[model samples]
Target: MVTYTGDVTPGGAPDVRDAGGLRITKVAVDEKMSNNCYLLRCRTSGAQVLVDAAAEPDTLLPLIGEAGLTTVVTTHQHWDHHRALKAVVDATGAEVAAGFPDADAITEQTGVEVTRPVRQGDVVRVGEVSLEVITIAGHTPGSIALLYDDPEGHPHLFTGDSLFPGGVGNTFGDEAAFIQLIDEVETKVFQRLPDETWFYPGHGGDSTLGAERPHLAEWRARGW
Candidate 1:
């Protein structure tokens, strides 16, 4: 069984590592063009998940180790998120998983080799915890969010560049697609979830589903 060590706000950068029945860590990396990168881990099994591996591999690796990471997960294909993937993969033997659309880019950029291509509806498990994948394709063709049920608390969301604290993730590829993705988030992920769900966004501070739900209509009214 996993225990909660509460939320620790480590000094230096915007990195956070939370340990529940499973572990969830985020390391701030300079997005080549966007924002920060987040690294998540499952403490009990040492299974690691990287939302974006952009930051310095040397600095980031130690933090991952501090959290007892074992694998990596990419949130999108932006250069910032995956720039140091090859180095990290080499060191940890950690298989990288990304959305289906970014598979080609992930393959072309970091040839270290990917273990598998994860898509919507896929569940990545570690020990007794399982992260459910929900594809939100607007910021990038293959942008995916990982959702998990906190065995000890409310459900949590690792929203990679999809939903943020105040607004939403950046849209770089398709405008219509992004708009559609926003709608999908509303009906499928957002509305369907209980109000108590806590969202761990790729950027900015965390927010609760209850607090943010009211703003969805506002985002839609403004054209999303």
Candidate 2:
């Protein structure tokens, strides 16, 4: 397997990687916004689940192809994360899923009803692979992360705007919110998962738990 750098640029070809049972394709879209949209396809069943249809249905629909998307999961209620949500769902007739707390806001913003209002423990299946929903709120009321404990290998996490490469996501200067988000991530993610676990963020390159573990205190103290 070639190294999956997780580096993508707008209008560039996607970065694809195989995670044991599934394949993850990270596509950067939306011009200057450069938001990332992930396409998770189950190797066996060919069923696909897209994470954060941020923009450019023109780019995303082609990736979906004829097999079509089974589900479109919006990481949070952020406008930058779901710009092409309505269009993608409309094109593929895919089911919409988002954190339970932010479902209403997503529906209101995109005019797409969240058929699956997933909570922390919800399991979202994409073909043969099952992703456990981990609600890491505070960045947004419904910000969530998806964990696929790849049975054949190490774990893979899809941490939307909440958890990123350098630190937890931007809380918009809300100290209390930052604390809440960090605490949730530390307890639910850092403490529970091993160091080898690789995580994919909504934007930019990915990182492993081991690489970011030592900076927990720095992030907490810095408070951004």
In lDDT terms, how accurate is model 1?
0.70
User: What lDDT is reached at residue 82 by model 2?
Assistant: 88
List, residue by residue over 1-224, the lDDT tens digit for candidate 2.
56889999998999999998899999999778788889999999999999999999999999999989999999999989888998999999999999999999999998899999999899999998999999998999899999999998999999998888889999999989999999999999999999999999988889999999999999998996
**Per-structure clash totals for the candidates:** 6, 0
lDDT (Cα, tens digit) per residue for candidate 1, span 141-200 = 888888887777788887877887666776655568668878878876787788888777
* Lowest lDDT 10-residue stretch of candidate 1: 2-11
Candidate 1 segments whose C-alpha is farther than 4 A from its true place: 1-19, 31-35, 66-69, 172-174
lDDT of all predictions: 0.70, 0.93
Worst 10 residues of 2 by lDDT: 29-38
